[model samples]
Target: MSEAVLETRDLNKNFGALQVSRNINFRLDAGARHALIGPNGAGKTTFVNLLTGVLSPTDGAVLLNGRDITHMRQDRRVKAGIARTFQINTLFAGLTVLENLYLAVSEHLGRAGAMFRPAGARREVVDEAMAALDGLRLADDAGKTIRELPYGRQRLVEIAIALALKPKVLLLDEPAAGVPSAESHLILDVIEALPEDIAVLIIEHDMDVVFRFAREITVLVQGGILASGPPDEIAANAEVRSVYLGEGTHD
Candidate 1:
């Protein structure tokens, strides 16, 4: 069988006396779209940190393509093909959409030698950035500063930035946290249409998008793995229903 692109075995974390993540086991194959979901305080964010090296796990291992990277630094993890998007949008506020993407592409390509050039003059870099923008349907806004775009479009650009990194694993924390329903749908479409080479692990509170996009769902409660499987199976599990879904509802 092909090796897992990313996996965590018995991963644990603590803050003072509080156990934020407890023996959480997760695995994602190449090209898998795995969704992590739970009610508030379920430790999903903590788990994302563990995988991305933002917060070191108090115990256990994180293996990327079968190599131990449990304690690697955050920047090292990004260099190792692990890229993430924050819940809040992060972008180059004063730069145009094309310029924002150009930086991302340049950062990944390690092209610091050309940083001084006018963004438009770097024909090859600009072309790649424009292509990425076009892929995300933001090509028309390429010339506009990020601040000029709507909240939703800015969010798309954030994902595009991560995509420019050419990650093998993409950890997204609440990609649609505060957008309007209509814009959220657009974000979902952008997410679903991501290139097949990247493995997407998303933490979302929106059950509608979770059920629609996830092929596999992992549920957490109080920092522990409560259940994980296909969405239909998890949605039907009695314990999950009682702990998360409340009484008498199959949603």
Candidate 2:
């Protein structure tokens, strides 16, 4: 079994009297394909923000490979091998795919601001960017602007840019949102094809995508864990069925 590379221990979060996340403990092992799902006001977004260091928890610790990082800064978390994508596409619409990827790769390599880098380093950065695009099956459109691509492909490019960060853990937030059914296959393919060394967590409301992508699922309701287990078990869970699966979740 793989070791738990990312974890939260008895975590809690509050906005004044609103307790959004409470006493939450979660773990993600190497190459773990985990999903977090719930209804509209379930605090799912709050919990994820805490995990990514975008928001501080009221209590408990965030750990990476057993090291405590409860107070780590956002950029530091990224450098520590945690990366995430949002529900919406955040790519530079005017930039070509290659340019976009090159920026991320260069930033990861610490050559983003180098006005005079050796030719060898530049070549390496270019190669890394190309590899990331190729991995996403997006090499053919490397020269195309983000505006020229479909929403789904743009989403994949965002993920590819995250991959360029060479993260050990990846968190994807609603990757298939706004994507047409026809184009969703592309996103699903790239997500499933991600490297096995990276632990991945997905936050999505699309039942079809979530049920198909996650081996294990975590159900959240009113700031607490309702159920967590394998896909079949989650599907069979009584509370999940009555509260979320029946109405809120969708294909």
Candidate 2 has which clashing residue pairs, if any? none
- Residues 8-61, candidate 1: write the lDDT tens digits: 999989999999999988898898888998878989988988899989999999
TM-score of each: 0.91, 0.92
Q: How close to the true structure is residue 248 of candidate 2, measured as C-alpha lDDT? A: 60
Off by over 4 Å in 2: 116-121, 249-251
Task: Evaluate model 1: give its TM-score.
Answer: 0.91
Tens digits of per-residue lDDT, candidate 2, 77-157, equal 988999888888988889899999988888788787788775336788999999999888899999999999988889999
Q: After superposition, how far is residue 103 of candidate 1 from its true place, in Å?
A: 1.9
Candidate 1, position 145, lDDT: 99
- What does the lDDT come to for candidate 1? 0.87
For all candidates, the clash counts are 0, 0
